[model samples]
Target chain A: MTGAVMNPAWALLAPVVLGVLALAGAALNGVFVARAEGRPALSGAARPVLEVMRLMRQRRRVTVAADRLLWRIGGMALLVIALLKTAVIPLGPWILADISVGIVWFNAMDVMVWAGMWLIGWGANSAHALAGGYRFLAQAVSYELPLMFALVTPAVAAHSLRVSEVVDAQQDLWFVVWMPVAFLVFCGSVLAFSAWGPFATAAGADIAGGILTEVSGVDRLLIMAGRYALLATGAAFAVALFLGGGSGPLLPDWLWTIVKTLVLLAGFIAVSRRLSAIRPDRLAEVAWIVVLPLALLQTLVVSIIVAVRG
Target chain B: MLSIIVFSALAIIAVASGIAVFRVDSMARATYALAVSFVAVGVMLVMFDLDYIGVITILMMVMEMAIMAIYMIMFMGMNPALMPMSMVHNNRWSAILATGIFLLLAAGALLVPWPARSGTAAPDLTVAVGEALMGSKMLVMLTVSPILFATIVAALVLANPRGRYDRWGDNLKRVCPDDPQQGGLGK
Candidate 1:
């Protein structure tokens, strides 16, 4: 069905699908984090993976030298900033539940990630933690450019920074098809931005667990959850931009949207599983040398195509 | 019904994950929850007739968190997932502050004077949005690409640790004498 044809059934299915995919994504992401930490996925008696949260909350440990107040604030801020970013997301037809600046708002929210991370790393009062925080700035600076280019490709094609408009633009053709190069670049940036595999050096366990090393108690919880939210948010954009929001043949619009989202998320999980963690220096290399050029080419190509087609 | 379903789904995930961001016991878990919450919110954006923004929300958050999680592991020198750590601090004040902010925002939402719908929601809001963006804000579209390209080149120049000497020999035919591998030329 075309965008002109509104299917309510699909709408219902979309959220449900998104919810399931989200849960799965979370589970998968958690599994990877567990693996990287050198814990068994599932162990006898303890269910090693499941024991993760249980162990974290069981006792609170804060480094003696860390600043208690900033440490705690940093933790809470991590989640809050993530949520703030979400406030502007356009789900389906309900724009005003809290919708504002669409994609721009989401980009603005990213600043929170830097702020919260720096605070947590600084508050931890450890050299490694500080270094991780410092490296984050470097990594952030490198990847963010490509990420932004990838993001704008869709906006350029759809003619709007507003995500809803971009999805609507897919009515005739999914942006992914029109701008295949941009879609790949965007996906790559998402993976890098999330630090899923190749670009995970900033917080490498060897370096410090970098930022969160000294954090403990409820503070750790906040930081971790914030990271998950970031992943979920990133996955949502993948679905919206490349896959086309809620588009399917038999399924309701929403359901189709959800299915697409989960499918993309599965890829995220799969990639997360297969790739080795990237060191900070290497992340910079890939982001600058590889991702950057590709993104530039993508934007240029998409613009030319749009110009020619229009 | 559609609105309710969409709003509720986005709100639940967004808020739950928002809360979870601080509620989880470890740094990694918190990051994941935050990402999920943001994804939910992005979905909501799609529902809101703001497709462009909604998709962006998802894309931006995922990359940001992945990086954050890795940094958590590397710098900490511990398996971030396995190591149990406290994630909360300033419980009483934070709770109070968060709650107070929530209430204030809620009140503003409820009390604010909302604008009336003008000209029956654009037949296709996306098209309208696209036209407005490209027609009026074309400069952003024009400028962003080049700026991004420059940034990429600058990043490359700044980040690399080695140069041609690090890879090739002085003669450009044979491998360098200081090569670490036994057969530098792959012979």
Candidate 2:
């Protein structure tokens, strides 16, 4: 009876607890990032997007020109897709829906970010919103290449697209230690994907809050919440990919896992803040020509290293 | 029971937001709606027992949206969700393609023969995952780190119009307040 009872429960424990913890990790990471950059820290950095949601709930204003349906859809889609990707990630020993092509699936789901943003911008019908939408396409085009390359590097090195396999491959040596260059590139891409500073060309004050300018009330809140959750998730990937994910001394596997995730997130926020003064166009250019090539080179080096070691 | 409740709630939220992805009026609203949908999905995935994947889903999407929003603000110079614009330029074709793809994917999901467990499961899944990573796959990751650094440099070179000298003045001696000829931020 105990065996049967424990089995399912144990199976469930890994996914759910770690999932929540991972969410928590991103917030913690952002807080550290903010603090490192001499910005104000809050308990809510553990949940950086609460303010946006609060603001949203407080109002429900809509411009007359916006497409009613698409406007509502954009915010909603962003959050759901972000969450769906998390279902495949493995924390410590637990995973849900571990597909053979888990990596590809994860990437495919992420493309929704691009689609949703475009829809949002186009639907809003405002000139500025349209421009912001176009900027997203441009930035996505540039950063995605390097990001994909960086993501594939791990699969190539591991000889499997399964994230679990990729993680398994890292036991002897954290990929970050061995492939420092790839690590850096992956980190950069994560930042780009997250729209952290230096690369935050789209949504700053200069852009009048970017694509979200027209959004008021609860819709705005949902989007903001989605952003925080996304931030947390991205940071967790960094931990999983390069860092020896959840590998540490003494602490329970879950606690260590959270700690590692927070560290990566802090690093991202710090980088984002550091690049605050830089222009977005400059950032985009660097991501494409420079970062992409470096990522390719990193892949080559890893292939060579594996070839020689094998 | 708690797990069931949590997951059910998450699933409902995810599905609701997923619908909203296409239901909203403005671009910004759609973005937010989609974000909420993803968050709910991520949470639901956590309930599904894939912590790493679920967490990453949240992180990657957040950053992606942030960049998207940044672009929206910078270029549009207005709120993206407030205006009524036609996002579905080629609606009929897109619908057909989307439906076709969904059907094919669903078919695969249902029909494909999945691999059964071959070996005994590891007691500690995390450690097992760790072993697989370092045991063989470290090389691929090894190569990509420098690629990221190079990207940083390239972004700087391509994006910035001026160099260090432009900002600091010619001699690095003083700020030229009157210099309208600055190339980068200094100008």
Using TM-score, give the best candidate's number.
Answer: 2
Q: Taking the tens digit of each residue's C-alpha lDDT, what string does model 1 give over A1-310? A: 2123334454454434334444566676666666778886543223333434664666777575565555676678756765565444444443322332466666656645665666677667678887777777666767677877887788888777666777778877787876776777666656654545655565777885888677665666656656655666677777777777766687776566556666777687678677787555546656677778888889898889889989
Q: Once model 2 is optimally superposed onto the true structure by TM-score, how far is the C-alpha of residue B90 displaced, in angstroms?
A: 16
Candidate 2: tens digits of C-alpha lDDT, residues A144-248:
777777788888878877777787788888888877877777676666555556655555567776777677677766665565556666666666677766677
**Interface RMSD of structure candidate 1 (Å):** 9.9
Model 2 residue A50 CA deviation in Å = 6.5
Q: In model 2 chain B, where is the ten-residue run with the lowest total lDDT?
A: B178-187
User: lDDT per residue, candidate 1, B1-187, as tens digits?
Assistant: 9799879978987998898877766666677678778878887987877765776777678657756765675665355443556678778998899899999999999999999978677898769999987988788889999999999988997787654556566656654434444231233
lDDT computed for candidate 2? 0.66
What is the TM-score of each predicted model, taking all chains together?
0.58, 0.59
True contacts kept of 1: 0.00
